[model samples]
Target chain A: MNWMRTEMERPGQREQFQDALLRGDRPAVEEMIRQELADYPYWRDELLGELTEQYLEGAVPFSQLTVLAEAAAALAEHLPPVAVCGSLEGNPGDTGRNFIQMLFRAWGVPTLDLGADVPADHFLDAVSGQGIRFVIAAAFSADDAGAAMLLHQKAMERGIRDQFDLLICGAKLTEETGKKLQLACMDHRAAAVARWVVQTWKNR
Target chain B: MEKQMIFPANRFALVPDRDEVFAWLQCDAGPCRAAFEREWVPALQLLEETMTPVAVCAQRNANALTVFLTIGKETEKRVSALFQEERYILGSLLNTLCDEMLFQMDSKLANILQRELVSEHLYMAERLEPRVHLSPETLQADFGSLQSMVPFARVTTSGVLYPAKSMLYRIVLTGESRTVSALHDCARCDQADCLYRNRKHESLREKEKLPERELKESTKRRKRLVWREEIGIPVLLSSNASVDDNSEVSRFMDYFKLADPNDAAYGALSDRVHLLTC
Candidate 1:
């Protein structure tokens, strides 16, 4: 096995903090991120996101993942709380990462984890109880979209449809379903969606 | 009886690259501008010392194909020891490290399977791990099937593989011969939006030398056909003159029990296959 591995290809660090993050040297990574966030918010956000992807791919260790989460949490401190949940039917190899919540953190948004296989009533509760404005629904399989649609209909029934933004993400969600629910069917890339949300939130 | 093969120590034993492990550990390579490497040695040593790779492969013709690989129970035993000693960080890192260690064996394991498997047009598309590509029940049954093959391994009532590190890779086969590729597993993974996902856009003409006409054959009717083994759906691309897809789409969708035509599942079916006439 050793012989099969060629010269170890060590990648160059894109920023001062990345090498520290990868080593799971959280204190150093945090210090560097704290410094960068003072001026280079975009740089800090993008790099942390890039590293989280590596973690998801199993390239990095658990410690590195924690570093990424902590760093993202720093960026997200000023943002309002949001809600997150999805079916248990997808991302089976997730290894307890609960990455959508992490991704919400990465987007610099705090989240309330409603737990798995959550129903429409649970989402409505997060909205009403938490005064949450954005509800991210994940549908790994198309069938999982049903819960989000139900949530939307319930929101409308409660006369609160205009109060919150409903986004359905995951690989199999379609515009047709989004249109029917009058929801934003989105790509699962958290960075882009996060950017849009931040701008919208600021304006609102 | 199905052919069951056990890998010898040499066949299964592997040491993954120290650099890979180090980089993954996020160690320093300062002059090369890397993280400090020494910090990771104890952990890697713990993993290398503890893991004993054992593998068993079995398949029934056309029905099922599986290769079961596990770092013997000792690896997890040591991890549990670390946890009991309140070395939770090390324990967690060890757990993740074992997965990295196990999955790095994917290529060698696939090679072993290829050597033993007798086939014609059938070729493995990718390794589909349970829970990732399959449901718990499907994996439960797959494990039950393996009970007779890898008797040393065990499966819980809930379909969790035993030895904690044990992994079952289902051999996914496409109907036609594909260019045997070293395509990274990420390339084939269905998570199109995964930050780590890699997509290969090589032309069919370049990769397979498939004559465009033959692969995109339209039955004497002028509608073109596109197919993918994973989707098991035929995307019939008809121009303004022809229908949206083959007449078989509705029946096939029903047969597959797919959600709906407007669903992302069908969109994925279209995306996975190329538009031939274009």
Candidate 2:
């Protein structure tokens, strides 16, 4: 229980963990998290963190977002009072964006969805004088992906970037690009975003 | 070999109800109204051009009967292409048209099946719809009888029909006569508050214990659930919906529709609402 020794993390266990997460089997995730009390941090980071990385890289299929959102919903109580989310303007079929909002909704997280193809300024205005903790922007098109970065850039230029967490998401986002732009980038999936949000909240 | 009957390209097109389709799209008026006004006729025309509505009916072992109806894969693709192109209103209208078509097709087929069964002196005593009356095991075990006709559709391991728009039904035939439309499979459920029974949130909002006038919007009443049939999306409303409590003829979108009546997305809908029920 005191950060002792356990069997090494293996590809077999990793696959099983991912299958459980993607299937929204929280009990299995909880079981694996508590599999062995030994080296608790190692197990949590390796299993969950690595899974988030896989999700960010677009290794996970787009259709699995709901189950993945369900997996992340356990962290609901840890969520902020309210947040704003939307797909960048003019992107048709806001399925991914809706699913992500639904992810927040699953935990009864109060989200002001600006609807698909939102102008970045609407986001800025929604949080003004409001208790918003973060902004989750989804981009379904290559153009909207640029809009996400643009939103981050505008938030920074206005010196309002520090006001709330700005999470830009697209399949195109990468750790390399995020670091290069110095923007808080998110994976296309909300599950990982939720996890990142919780981690960021804890760190804050 | 199981004998199969496939109705291909029959002049059996059922024109969808315009108001119902508009209601499903949440676009009875306003910004979408103009779009819907401009596009519905053309959209219906396009749907008719693209959809290959088909029905398959088979008389199974003894007197068992089964029927599957679909507007075909290409019709679904056409609707998907519209959504993909971001013609949200038109695409949604056409999308709901497909469902209305399937629904009309189901009723028509059911009647046809009824007539056939009656002539053979067999009564359609009991009927089962896939998700409604049939259990997962029953759907999986029973789908084999109809699968060969639908090359693209199959019951999943968990028993959801692929190409979700496709409809499946099985009608039980018996020697004894029974009323054609009897209380259905819902009688079997034990859960008191099923969404299926309570989908009429508009009505329930009236029957809500506390009148809307007494409840302060900021008091934050416990959230209630409402569903729009065939809208292809979910609506999770914000709790700030205490103003303009026009529950009658209010679309699901009206609950959280922005306050400014001039807002592009939902402006006309909220403003045009009257006391009449649609």
Candidate 3:
């Protein structure tokens, strides 16, 4: 029913939108996204994807990053809640996990933001204690990887691994690491992860 | 707990340059720039009206120098009273600005040391090794000796060195040339939350002169500087090794005199002893 969604549905428009974001066309991106939001309030995944790409490319400043995240969170108000956590130790500056949370919120997915330096037990408590079904865990440093492994080990110890879906992301998180931990490795692309979350929720 | 000695305030003098402090405020002005600008004038006026600069004496031991410092008592009282009355955000801003001014005063003191004593390096263990270096208890224990140095500042019964905005630091004098050993290695330190480490990493990356694509690709695997644990000079003590429970107990006992349980002060002394030991 939304014209902007219909326009975005046109072939290559999504790519153009992504290109605009990549080129750092803030005004154009803001105007188009705001217009799109007026009718297709749930059209957050695509925008999140573009923003994520820009962030990964090192085009977004920290202040602008927060603004983008807040915008995404605003759109995500109608979605079911999820839980996301950054590394227990500080993430390397390159890690975009915080932005990924913004992308999650943009997809109308309510998120419990367990901030950086979270302990393993805290992550487990958020899952089993709060009855959260899906978790997005991110790590950026060697210490962060250790913390993530500890979280997984604790979850396994408590026999609650089967109770929730754990999705891992970050530069340090490889496919081998994901396999070792028995968790899905969400690709670095925020839009792809956002879409996956939407599809998974629909299937559920 | 070694006994502390406090020298008279006449032994040292600290004069803060308003311009240098303003320059530092501007340099550190990032996200807080607007707030800093809005508060700077009023804060400066308040400081001019209420503040008194005071320096505590220093002790020189061969190659080491220990200096204690604090902004005078009246200013601390005024600031605390203001903080209690003001909104949380504004109070925090004022507090930070005052701390910055005090830090500027400390910098001036360091400069004076360099000029008078021919010392080139000044080090605060807190700033250098935030996680593992000198603990507050050790500083407080050492501050006992220097407590009488500043008449206005007091060491709380719990061994907290007060005039909350205070600094205790050591100086390094290298004759003829100023060459400090590069001891901080970000990759080696367990303090992942340190902003200094993050800034160093960013600076190192900038110095690499790599193209964007190459920089991105190489950042993950780039070799990191590792800290060497060897000490070049015997003068600098290992900050990590300086403080222990046994020493803390000895110091606390010396400060409070907790020798006999049957003494009239036994109950209060026992409570303090328990708190210190625990």
Which prediction has the highest DockQ against the true structure?
A: 1
Give the winner by TM-score.
1
**Distance from true location, Cα of B211 in model 2, Å:** 21
Residues B1-278 of candidate 3 have per-residue lDDT tens digits of: 32233433343443434333333333233333343344556766666666566665454443444466665555555544543332222333344455655655666665555455444334322122212233334445545566566656654322234555665543433344443332334543433443235444554565676555675455433322111122121222212332234565444433332222233343554443343222
Give the distance in Å from residue B44's predicted Cα in candidate 1 to where it truly belongs: 4.1
Q: Tell me which of candidates 1 and 3 scores higher on TM-score.
A: 1
Return the DockQ of model 3: 0.02
lDDT of 3 at B121: 37
Query: lDDT tens digits, residues A114-197, model 2?
Result: 765687788877767576777887754233445666676777777787788777654445455566446564565566666666
Candidate 3 CAPRI grade: incorrect
Give, for candidate 1 chain B, the lowest lDDT window spanning 10 residues.
Answer: B195-204
**What's the candidate order when arranged by decreasing TM-score?**
1, 2, 3
- Model 2: CA > 4 A from native: A1-204, B1-3, B29-31, B182-278
Model 1 misplacement above 4 A: A1-80, A85-100, A106-108, A115-121, A139-143, A146-163, A170-172, B1-11, B18-103, B114-278
Writing each residue's lDDT as its tens digit, candidate 1 over A24-125 gives: 454675564443334334555566556556654656443454445444444455444765444323222222324455546555566665544566777777
Clashing pairs in 3: A76-A108, A88-A117, B1-B250, B1-B251, B4-B145, B5-B145
Model 1's CAPRI class is: incorrect
Compute the DockQ of candidate 1. 0.09
The order of the candidates by DockQ, greatest first, is 1, 3, 2
Deviation of model 1 at A97, angstroms: 6.2
